[model samples]
Target chain A: MNTKTFETENQLIRAAQAGDQQALRELVEQYSDTVYKFAFKVCRSEDDAEDTLQDAFLNILKALKTFNHRSNFSTWVYRIVSNSCLMKWRKEKRERWESFERLDNPEERIQDSYTHWPDSPAEALLSNELQEKMDEAILDLPPIYRLAFVMKDLEGLKMEQVAQALEISLPAAKARLRRARLFLRDRLEPYVQS
Target chain B: MADELKERILNICSELGEDIDSADCKKLRQHVASCQDSSAFVDSVKKTISLYKAYGPNIDHDTSSRLLGKLGLD
Candidate 1:
């Protein structure tokens, strides 16, 4: 199923690479949700995510002609979005640092307030409350870990693809993903066990 | 011993049923099934991943259109 879709996307990419404006538009439309969702999760802010989305597409357009097709188009786009998000994060962090003299204590940022779970563990795990908690937990992860988690687990990218997108080694990507999953598992253990 | 096995199983299980198709994945699945703790850990991680999979945040149609227009591609 996924392989067929990937092949189709590759065909469209080939067309777009040949200067087919319609094909390029179609590609953007097809990948918009994917890029937007990934951006939203990684940036943890809708506005920043939107900005990243815009910047990514613009860069994709500029680079489309030079695209060597060495990597999957989706992987290339992910790399673009990842870079945009990181740039936005750094810019924001710098601005924040200039505005505020001191950073908040990291210990204070931990979320320890637990919600009561329902009687059935299955029911509790499936509940919207748990989903919200999980979302919050994902957002709370450190930026690199969160990106690894989002790309591998949420975006359903392959580990190799995640590594390529992040410009990291395969082992490094796997380690980050493992740590991210462990952190999430530990955070949600109470609700899952309840 | 079980804790280490569970952790190792989890690291492999995370990539299972997805793009991974290695012999290691098959072996890990068999091991996870035989062990109670590893089985539960696999199930929990699967559930956690499913929640993330179900999260669909669509980019508004207008947003895409606006982006295209801004890029002079429309």
Candidate 2:
């Protein structure tokens, strides 16, 4: 969410919690993109993302009455979507056990890596091919790392928020993000240099 | 010493856009300026993140309305 929308989000949350249906509709409109994008990135499938998105908002409406306004509503919604994404992954058997291994061993760096920064990466990334490669690289990441990276980097969540969403320690979230960056750097090095 | 420097550089890269003006970051910036490898590492990581940031995706209108309809908000 952008700064402007985030500022209003709290008000909407309070209003929605107070049984304002219009506020609830506004909240959904504001967050649907963020939630859907997160789901698509994590689930890597449009159908799965759509399912998760629908379930997330429905669950949000059901749970809104119990929301105590302790945490940011966005963070609470992220927790819901993250849970939904994980459940979908588990049912699909997409969450690999090795993701935990990679998360545990931060010392193991990407091997045989060579990278030369492109002079115009912003321009280079505009190309459809490179964008597709970047998307694929993200999808190929281990689920743990992917979630951390997507939440922190793509979704623009703070480290603490990411940790909260993923139900991990702050340090664990940081480690996963670092490893995810290194892993993606290795995968996209060829394109960067070319 | 080299491994430690590399680790510090990578850590700085990970912390990009957060606190790039800290004493340690200033020192790392100087080190990067003097060292080609460190500079390359920092630049590449920044580029990688920029690419990721540039690829924003939006929810389709149909999907949004369909979801809203299901929730009876439409």
Candidate 3:
């Protein structure tokens, strides 16, 4: 919320709105990395992520003129990218999904031993096994919930911002986040706690 | 641990959010101090989030450049 930063963003938006190609490019460049990372996390495939990124910016380009600027530019960008991701991938069917009741059941979590996972050192977190498990766990989530989880947890957006970006009510967003976290925690339990 | 205690502790942990000083979080911590299952569950969930938060893989340089080209901005 620095005044200078906010003013600079305002300037950039005005320039882009006025058909300044350089301004448009600066806008894209500033957000491209974030967009790509988010797309990758949601789509969980390089090809899909790339396509989503391209589709997202194309949408941004088309909508920039009428953007009304109601939301900040970053939130607007996230909204577009999240929509692109859902539209592109939500149709794919999964073999099965863990039910919410099953995930929340205490009986399902009752392991004989109650040891916690080791402190995840940076090395372990960056290791291939952990990364692959995280990727698989994310992909296993239904697309909508996956988007919510990625936005709130991985991207570190606030709960309100997540609801805004996803066009959902705050409680709905929180529900998705809680379930997504539960699913992921269960998937990772054997790997970490064992 | 009784199933009731287990469920209560996990519920508290889930609702804790990021406010460590909140009353619910304080209660959860107090319960976790005496409950191994609660302690393990909290630790593992925190670990899961931290692990995935570290799993960011960027688009390669070539891919980024190609994106710009596709957009006719290069």
Give Cα-based local distance difference scores for all models: 0.69, 0.71, 0.70
What stretches of model 1 exceed 4 Å from their correct place? A1-20, A93-107, A110-128, B1-6, B12-26, B32-34
DockQ of each: 0.29, 0.40, 0.41
Task: List model 2 lDDT by residue over B1-74, tens digit each.
Answer: 25455456656645653322446666777866877776666566667776776643478899999999988989
Could you tell me how far off, in angstroms, the CA of residue B22 lies in candidate 1 after the best superposition? 7.5
Angstrom error at residue A20, model 3: 1.3
TM-scores of all candidate predictions against the true structure:
0.73, 0.76, 0.79
TM-score of chain B for predicted candidate 3? 0.60
Runs of candidate 2 with Cα error greater than 4 angstroms are: A1-11, A95-129, B1-8, B12-26
State which docking tier applies to candidate 2: acceptable
Clashing pairs in 3: none
Instruction: Kindly report which residue pairs in candidate 1 clash with one another.
Output: none
lDDT of 1 by residue, A48-151 (tens): 66788899888888888877888887888888888777776676543322311122222323343232222455544467667557655665566677788889
- CAPRI verdict on model 3? acceptable
